[model samples]
Structure formats: C-alpha cells, structure tokens
Target: MINKMEAKHLDFYYKDTQALFNINLPVEKNAVTALIGPSGCGKSTFLRTLNRMNDVIEKTKVVGEVLMDNKNIYDPDVDPVELRKKVGMVFQQPNPFPISIFDNIAYGPRIHGIKNKQKLQELVESSLKSAALWDEVKDRLHDSALGLSGGQQQRLVIARVLAVEPEMILMDEPASALDPISTSKLEELVRELKNNYTIVIVTHNMQQAARISDYTSFFLNGKLIEYDQTNIIFTAPREKQTEDYITGRFG
Candidate 1:
C-alpha cells in the first residue's frame, strides 16, 4: 500500500503533561484508517498532529516527525497553513458558517484566490455533490447553512473541506452526534470517500471502525498498542490489550 503519511516516534505534550508516546503508524493512500480507543487515549491529539492543529494551543509541544509525501511536515520551513490545506479536518461537531450554503463552500476557494463567479458556482456544485449533499441543497443554494439538519451540516462541512481540494481528510468522531440513520449515511459517505481521499478517523465507536476502516489502530493510555487490518484487529489482534479492548473487557 502507498502510504500518504507516516508518524514516526511521535510524542506530544500539553505543557508538562505528556499526552502521546512513541506513535508510529502509516496512513495508506485512498483508504480509511481508524484510530480507536476510549476517551483521553490521545487519539484526537495524534489526529491533530497530522496537520499541526495542536499548534494553536499554547504550551503544547510535539516531538518527532509526521511525514507527508516522504517529507517531515514538522520541519522548520514547512508552513502549517499549507500543510492544513493539504490535510483538512472535521471536528466532532459540525461547524458550518452561518452564511448561505453556497457561500460556506465557496469560502475556502475564495480564500485561496479563485475569484470568477462561474468558477465559484461550479466549485460549489461539485463540492456539494462530492459530499453527497448537492441533491438535497442544490435548489436552496442561497439559503442559510445553519438551517440544515445536523447530518446535512456535517456533510456541508465536508463539502467545505472538498472545496479546498485536500489530499487527506482527518475526522474526529464525526458520527457521534448523529442519529442512527444519519450515522449510517455518514458511514456510507465515508466508504465512498475512501476511493478518492486518504482518510484518518478517530472514533470511540468500535463498530463504526469495523464498518468503515481498512486499517485500525488501537491506542491506550497515550500509546499505540496494535495496528493492523481491521478484520484481524477485530478478530485476532496480536496484543492482549487490543483483544481486551475490542471485546469490551476494558478500554
């Protein structure tokens, strides 16, 4: 498998408290890799490290390398903004701009300097379609995005990410807030999205991980315990900790 990104001996700290330890993992291209663990296992911390999202938090430090396309993204010269553009993020909650749906998706591209009206419209249409939201909102393009359902808002946030043309997408428990039906729809969307975007998702839901991810990494107490094929990790993990966690023996 072609690895789109890799974390080598990665460690992170919030002030003096260490949050992650010696994480080494490969994110394969055009596939979904899920990070699974209980709360405070550092899954989200490690996810943020991928695009330097942790940089926004004061007194936080990262040690080791996160390589993208074989180059260490943590290198001094690499711009976090540029890295973030290549690796877009979606949070646990959907956060759509309160503006019109058309403008929300257009926001990123416009920031990146695409100014023509027709081109913006095309991007808006295509991005919404890619996110599986165009059919629902195509006629209501000028309507306020905040009026959308939670599921629609989440998908709209995804469309916003797509508008920027990211190579990789990071998701932090994206389905946790949705209803079962909406969660299923999001899962289906995730399955479809893997054909084009390399996705790394942090999910507390083991079932969700099994359903959507090609690879699964089990983290505990801020350390990586096992990383393997999803089926194997679910059925025959190499480590007892992984097996225990998967079987609900302990988190």
Candidate 2:
C-alpha cells in the first residue's frame, strides 16, 4: 500500500522540555492506524505534527520531516492553511459550531469560496450522509448545532471535516467522551470511512484500537516501541515494553 504520510526522525520540544524523541512512522493510505500509549506519551503530539497543527503552539520547536504524499509539510513554501485543508482533524470532545447545522457543514466550502446555495446544499447533504449523520439532522438543518446529542455533534464535526474533502482524518480520542452506544457508532463509522480516507487515531482505549484499527503503533515516552499489524501488536509484540504496556503491567 502507498504511504499517505511519513514521519522521519521526528522530535518535538515544548520550551525546554523534549516531548517526542526520534519517532518515525508511515501512515498507510485508506487504512485506520491507531496510535496507542498511556497518557502524556506524546501520542496526541505526534498526531499534530502530520498536518502541522503544532506550529501554532508558542515556544514549541519541531525537528525532522512530516512528509505528506512525498511533500514536506514543514517546508517554507508549504501553506499551513492548505495543508490543514488536506488534513482535517476531529478533537476528543465534539465541538460543533455555534450556528445552524447546515451552516456548520457548509463552513469549509464557504471559506474555500463556494458560493452557490444549491452547491452548498448538495455538499452538506452528501457530507452528512457520508458521516452517517444526514438522517438524524435532515429535519433540523436550520437548528442550532448545540441542540444535538453528543454523538450527533461528533458526527456533525465529522461531516464538517468531510465537507472539505480531506485526504486524511486525524482523530484524537474521538469517542472518549461518548457513551457506550455512541462510541460503538463512532467506531463503526470509522470502519466505514477507511474505504475513502486515511485515518490516524490517537486512542487510550486498547481494546478499541485492537477492535477497529488495521495497523497499530505503540509509543512509550515519546518513542515508538512497536509498529505492526493490530493482531501482532496485541498478541505478540516484539518489544518487552510493548508487551508490558499492552498486558497492563505498566505504561
């Protein structure tokens, strides 16, 4: 499979403290890859580097290359805005815009200069349908996004990202705050989405990662300890640290 994104000897620093150390990994195209480790292990930090989301952090410095489709995302000529458009992100908590549901999904296209109401309506419907949310919100297109349930809000966020037609989706513990049913729905949605988009998720739930991901990368203290097929990583990790971490011995 083609590599959608590659990180080479990546290291990150926040002020004087080092957060990531010589990390390297390739995210496969059209597959769900899970980044798993204990809290503060830099999983989220690593996810941010792919789309240059770390660039906005004050006093933060990043070393090495995050190459997307062979183009260095950190190159001086690379536009952060455009890079973000190609790589959409969904946060741990559902953050819907304080506007009508239709406007929320239409925001991306509007920013990119899509002005036709009919075109926007089509995009909204298609995106919402793609995210498995159109049916629920179809009747409430003009309703405030805040009025939706947690699961619906998260799906709305997904639809918003999809509206931009991003090549990759970065999810940072996307279902962590949801109830069991909602989380299951989100997981099912992720499975369905991998057919069209490359997905990289940073998750703390080991079983969730094992259940949904095609590949799993294990990190410990900012270093990649293991990268393998989901089954191998969970059943027979090569590194002792990975084995220990997955077996509940230690992080």
How far out, in Å, is residue 89 in model 2? 0.3
By how many angstroms RMSD does model 2 differ from the true structure?
0.8
Q: Which stretches in model 2 have alpha-carbon errors above 4 Å?
A: none
The weakest ten consecutive residues by lDDT in model 2 span 242-251
lDDT against the true structure, per candidate, is 0.95, 0.95
- Per-residue alpha-carbon lDDT of candidate 1 for residues 102-191, written as tens digits (9 for 90 to 100): 999999999999999999999999999999999999999999999999999999999999999999999999999988988998999999
State the lDDT at 155 in candidate 2: 94
The residue pairs found clashing in candidate 1 are none
